[model samples]
Target: MIHQVQRSTQVGRTTHSPKRRVTPIYAPGRRHPVGQVVGDAFIKHIAFSKHTLRSPRAIAFDVSTLDDAERAGAVVAEIHDTESRNVWTAPIALIRSKGFPVRRGFGNQWALTLEHWSRNGLQSEAEAREEQQAAKQAAASVVQLGLFGGGL
Candidate 1:
């Protein structure tokens, strides 16, 4: 013969603190992303340098909007010059990272512009007048007037 017994154990109840609500840091825009605005600005600065015939020694970027626990991107570049050095700082927006191709292409075009300026040393007012006169003369020589007074 076996006897059956029932046993009960008391358990304590634990209360947890309420969860804190987190608010979003950034809002979305048509051209700008919620957090990538800084990146865009930084890239734009780079592109500007490329096109504007400007050489900056250093560039510092601010990325406050995109600063998150998971990821925070930043940009800091230094360009060394033999004679002297200069520093430039700007914020990096998210839009620039996403639109890298467009930014890069624009930068390339800017670089070409700078190169042309560097090579030609930028024509002076007098030099421009001379060039215009030469171009006009060349055009005039290429075109001939026919008997009916029509350009051929």
Candidate 2:
């Protein structure tokens, strides 16, 4: 004869909830828009230009240190045009004495100014030399023009 015993079993069930999504939050502060930043830069440039023009003596000293003649002349011209109605003749003379070829053209002027900065330890010597060479080449390429005659 075989005897059978009955066993009781209990099962537990758990319910799970889905995770929620979150949005990014930003702090409140003055946001500098791109246009505003550009406008500020423009205003600063204008102010600096005005200040440079007001101080012709300083401008002369600054230009005198530059090695390029054209650049120096350009600086003088810029000062005269932007800062003062009267010409800054003294600065022009100072620039001419520095072996810079007095001439027209934006590049020539920039080269002269950069040369000055280079000579004064403000710029690397190599850079200054390069600018000088470029300016020289530019000047050499220009056809000579007399007071009355056109380009020769």
Clashes in candidate 2: how many? 5
TM-score of each: 0.18, 0.18
| Backbone Cα, N, C clashes tallied per candidate | 13, 5
TM-score of 1: 0.18
lDDT of 2 by residue, 1-152 (tens): 11112323233553443332211111122132101011101001113344332322122222222332222122232223233343222233434554343323322321123233222124534456888999987666564444447646
Tell me the spans in candidate 1 whose CA falls farther than 4 Å from its real position: 1-110, 118-121, 124-138, 146-152
lDDT for each residue of candidate 1 in 59-118, tens digit (9 for 90 to 100): 222233323311322342222222333322222232233212223332221111111111
RMSD vs true structure, all candidates: 22.9, 29.0
Give lDDT per model, in order: 0.30, 0.30
Instruction: Let me know the TM-score candidate 2 reaches against the reference structure.
Output: 0.18
